[model samples]
Target: MPSEQDLRTKIESGLPDLHNLIVTDISNGCGQSFDVVVISNTFEGKNKLQRSRQINNLLKQEIAQIHAFSCKCYTEAEWSKVVV
Candidate 1:
C-alpha cells in the first residue's frame, strides 16, 4: 500500500504544472483508498468528465492498487471559487 505522501508524489510527477495538489488517505488507516484534489492550469478548457479522465490516465498505476481513488480536478479559476 502506498503512503499518502507517495501517492501525492506520483500525482505531481505525472502531471505537469500541477498546483495545490492535495491527497487524503480515506481508508480509516488502511492506506488503500484516497481522495485527491488537484488544481492546475492544465485542466483549462476541459469539461469535468475530460478532466477526470485525464487524471485517471495519469494515475493508472496507483489506481490499480488502491481500493478506491476519488479525484477532484479543477482549473485555477474554479479552484479559487471552491476554496472560498
Candidate 2:
C-alpha cells in the first residue's frame, strides 16, 4: 500500500502548479478512497466537469488505487469567491 506521503508526492508531481492541494485519506488501510480539494490557475477557464477531468487524467494511475474520490477543484477566482 502506498503511504499518504507517496500519494501526495505523486499528485504534486503530476500537477506541479496546483495550489492549496488538500488530500485526505478516507479509507483506513485500504488505499481506496480519498477526498481532494485543489485550487489552481490551470482551472481558470474550465468548467467544473472539465476541471475534474483534468485532475482525473493526471491521476489516472492513482485512480486505480482509489475506489472513491470526492474532489472539489477550484480556480483562483472561485476560491476567492469562497473566501469573500
Candidate 3:
C-alpha cells in the first residue's frame, strides 16, 4: 500500500548513482501495476536483458507489490542521446 512517493524514495535510496528514474502507477488506483524507466551508469556495459535483470533484482520486494511492470533500462550514453 505504499504511495508513489514512497516507491520513488525507496528506488532513489537504493540506487544512489541512477541518473534518471521514473515510476508511474498504472493500476487504476490499485497500486498493483507500474511502468518504470531508469537510466544509470551501472548499466553501461550490459545488454538490455541484463539491465532489466539488474533492476528486477534490486526491486524484488517492490515487484511483488506490482502485478505488471513495464520497464525501460538505459545506460548513461543512451540517455545522453535521448536528451540531446
Candidate 4:
C-alpha cells in the first residue's frame, strides 16, 4: 500500500520543478483516492487533458491501484491569482 508521503515523493519526483503542489489522500487514510493540486510554469500552454495526461503518465503504476484520482492543475500565474 502506498503511503501519503510515498505518493508525495513520487509526484514531486515525476513533476520536477513543480511549485505549490498539494496531494491529499481523500480516502480517509485508506490511500485509495487522492485529490491533487499542482502549480507549475510547465503547465503554461497545456490544456486540461494534456495536463492530466502528464500527471497520469508519471503516476501510472501508483494510479493503477487507487480507487479514484482527481487533479487540479494550474500555471504559476494562475495559481497566484486563485490563491490570493
Candidate 5:
C-alpha cells in the first residue's frame, strides 16, 4: 500500500517538467487504490496510450502493491484547455 504523498513524489521525480500532479487515495484511506492526474510538457507529443504507459511504467512498483489505479495525463496546454 502506498500513500498519496508517496505516489505523488515518485511520479514527480519520474516525470520531468511536471506542471501538476494530483494523487488521490480512492480506497478510503486504506492506500489500496489511487487516481492520479498528471500534467507535463513531457507528454506534449504523446497520445493517450503513450501517456498512460509512461505513468504506468513510472509507478510500476507502487502499482503492484495496490489494488486499483487510474491515471489521466495531459500536456500543460491541454490541461489549460480542459480547465478553461
Candidate 6:
C-alpha cells in the first residue's frame, strides 16, 4: 500500500537537497508499481547502478511491498540536458 505521495515524501526526506522528483503509479492507482525520477546532487558522481542503489536503499521497505519499481536519477546538469 505504498502511495506515490508517501514514496515522494520519503525520497525528499532522504535526499533533502534533491532538485526534482516525479513519481507515477504505473499500476493504474493500485500502488503496486511505480516509476520514479529524481534529480539531485546525490547522484552527481554515481553511475547508474549506484544511483539506483541509493534510491532503492532509501525506499527499501516500500519497495519490498510493491510489485514493480523503477528509479532514474540524474544530477541537475544531467537533468537539464535530458529534458532540453
Model 5 score (lDDT): 0.93
lDDT of 5 by residue, 1-84 (tens): 789999998998888999999899988999998999999999988999999999999888999999999999999999999999
Which candidate comes out best when scored by lDDT? Answer: 6
lDDT of 1 by residue, 3-42 (tens): 7888788778888888789889999878899999999999
**Backbone clashes in each candidate structure, one number apiece?**
0, 0, 0, 0, 0, 0
Q: Rank all candidate structures by their TM-score, best first, as comma-separated numbers.
A: 6, 5, 4, 1, 3, 2
Global lDDT of each candidate: 0.87, 0.78, 0.80, 0.86, 0.93, 0.94
User: For residues 9-81, could you state the per-residue lDDT of candidate 6 as single tens digits?
Assistant: 9999999679999999999999999999999987877899999999999999999999999999999999999
Where does candidate 3 have its weakest 10-residue lDDT segment?
1-10
lDDT agreement of model 6 with the native:
0.94
Residue pairs in candidate 4 whose N, alpha carbon or C atoms collide under 3 angstroms = none
TM-score of each: 0.91, 0.81, 0.81, 0.92, 0.96, 0.96
* Residue 22 of model 5, lDDT score: 84
User: For model 3, how does the per-residue alpha-carbon lDDT over 1-84 read when each residue is reduced to its tens digit?
Assistant: 655666778778876578888888888778888888898888877899998887787778878877787789888889878889
RMSD of 4: 1.1
Write down the TM-score for model 5.
0.96
Pairs clashing in candidate 1?
none
Question: Which of 3 and 6 is ahead in lDDT?
Answer: 6
**Candidate 5 — which residues are off by over 4 angstroms?**
none
- State the displacement of the C-alpha of residue 16, model 4, in Å, after optimal TM-score superposition: 2.9
> How far is 55's C-alpha from truth in model 1 (Å)?
1.2
Report how far off residue 72 is in candidate 3 (Å). 0.8
Best by TM-score: 6
Better of 2 and 4 by lDDT: 4
